[model samples]
Target: MLGAVERPQAWPSFLHQVGVIELGKDRIEGSRLLVVASQANRGATFIAQSVTKQGLMRSYVQNGNPPWLFEFFVNESSNL
Candidate 1:
């Protein structure tokens, strides 16, 4: 389960519509948001589609090796 602060207002509705029932959560400000993708393009595409579809902020792929092999951060904004 996610902490209440970690659950964004848009998450329940948007994630369910896309079949994302649950995910690990972290603090919204200055914290990393990670998503796993096998290919870089797919990762980019997923981020683009989700941001567009869900009225979320636009984020960029982080440079350098992240904690996870397929990790990227979602820049925090009002949408989150």
Candidate 2:
């Protein structure tokens, strides 16, 4: 569960929120907003995707390659 203040209005905020979720960070904001804005399962999925995309972007910047292709590969591999 997340707090209200922890919920994000933009992409970066969303990403940060997800990081908090992953790291088990506490938030003073209510989780209601996150729940109301996005249903439980959807919100979780959105957070996961956002985090994965951010990870891919960071990796791309570090390696100087297309992140999307690598993202696709990783996603496919994960499914298998």
Best by the lDDT measure: 2
lDDT of each residue in 1-80, candidate 2, tens digit only: 34423544445646755676655534544433334433324434554575587654355456654566557556655654
Worst 10 residues of 2 by lDDT: 31-40
lDDT of 1 by residue, 1-80 (tens): 23322464645545553333232222344555454443534546655676689855534344443444245433322223
Instruction: Give per-residue lDDT, candidate 2, residue 69.
Output: 58
TM-score of 1: 0.24
Residue ranges of candidate 1 with Cα displaced over 4 Å = 1-40, 58-69, 72-80
Work out the TM-score per prediction.
Answer: 0.24, 0.20
lDDT of the candidates, in the order given: 0.44, 0.51
Write down the lDDT that model 2 would get. 0.51
Question: What TM-score should be assigned to candidate 2?
Answer: 0.20
